[model samples]
Target: MNLALWIAAGLLAAVALAGGITKTFVPKEKLARANGGGWTATASVGFVKTLGVLEILAAVGLILPAVLGIAPALVPVTAVCWVLLMIGAMITHLRHNEAKFIVLNLFYLALAAFVAWGRLGPEPF
Candidate 1:
């Protein structure tokens, strides 16, 4: 169970890190184009960058505390943060009529929720 949780956390971290880097460094026009336009069209660059920063922080929160065995309890807290972010993502996607992205958002939501539950339960780091 510990191994599984670590793997799940690692995967989530990697995805969040990648997302953060893209949103922070990539040009808005390119990101908008890549995301099918409708989404970023309604969002400001600052807002996107803010989300990116949150993602990067959450990614780090998920790993560092647990790995260092310092405040390992933060792992579940980070997972909860990811869950909230995914909920917001789902709402935003739905509002923009982006059904495709919502599915992925839901998947991420579930994964985050699982990590939250797992860490808070038997597999806590």
Candidate 2:
């Protein structure tokens, strides 16, 4: 169970990092064109960039505290934050009628929730 939690956290960290980097660096127009979606269009540049920064911070929080054996409790806390982020993402995607996207977001949400539960309960490290 501990190993499973680590694997899930690692996967989430990788995804969040990639998403953060893309959202932070890519031009808004380019992203819209690349994805051809209303999700980004519905949000302001500042808002998207802010989300990106938060995601990056969350990604770091998911790994660093636990790995370094310092303030390990932060792992579950960070997972909770990821859950909130995914919930918001799902809501936004649903508003855009992007059911397919919501499916992926839900998967991410579930993984984050699992990590939160595992780290807080059985897999404290």
Reference-based lDDT, each prediction: 0.89, 0.91
- Residue 4 displacement in candidate 1 (angstroms): 1.4
Position 95, candidate 2: lDDT: 88
Per lDDT, the best of the predicted structures is 2
Task: Candidate 2: give the clashing pairs.
Answer: none
- TM-score of each candidate structure, all chains considered together: 0.95, 0.97
Error of 2 at 40 (Å): 0.8
* CA deviation > 4 Å runs, candidate 2: none
Runs of candidate 1 exceeding 4 Å displacement: none
Error of 1 at 59 (Å): 0.9
Candidate 1, clashing residue pairs? none
Global lDDT of model 1: 0.89
- lDDT per residue, candidate 2, 1-125, as tens digits? 98899999999999999999999999877887777767887678999899889989989999999989999999999999999999999998888888998999899999999999999887788
